[model samples]
Target: MSLLIIRLLVFVLVFWAGWRLWQYWQGFQNQRVEEQQGKDGHESMVKCEECGLHLPSSEAIQSGKLHFCCSEHRDAYNTPPRDDKDN
Candidate 1:
């Protein structure tokens, strides 16, 4: 009777461990899916006119129809290059 009880206890422990492992695996999978969904979310992407770097439109600086990564890039793009040959 003691041996039978020990066997039953072991079985219950194994089942509990398996259930915990399954729960952990499911949580990990769900977290990965949520992260992937965040990366592929509805926000549109824009390219910087000066550096051509791509970033989310919401973070970009917009000047008229042009989009830039930062204010410096926008200013640089708007300013014409100085002519060294003309001097």
Candidate 2:
């Protein structure tokens, strides 16, 4: 009984350690990829057409050829003025 409990604890610890390591490696790979894209230049990064914020092109939301930081910005950008009817 005691031996079984010890083995379960050991397994859990090893599994936890491996999961943490995998997460760390994934983050490292993402950072390395971002660095490589920066070196490549030209359209690897994009400016948000709405807020003028810049980010990696891969992360930007696209409407036609223009990019936005998020869906809200994209929606806002495409939406017409409410006062257009008053004009």
lDDT of each: 0.91, 0.89
- Tens digit of lDDT per residue, candidate 2, span 1-87? 999999999999999999999999999998887686775534477899989999988899998999999999999999986775756
User: Residue 86 in model 2: shift from native, Å?
Assistant: 7.9
Off by over 4 Å in 1: 1-40
- Give the distance in Å from residue 70's predicted Cα in candidate 2 to where it truly belongs: 0.2
Alpha carbon lDDT at 45, candidate 2: 75
> In model 2, which range of ten residues has the least summed lDDT?
34-43
How far is 66's C-alpha from truth in model 2 (Å)? Answer: 0.5
Clashing pairs in 2: none
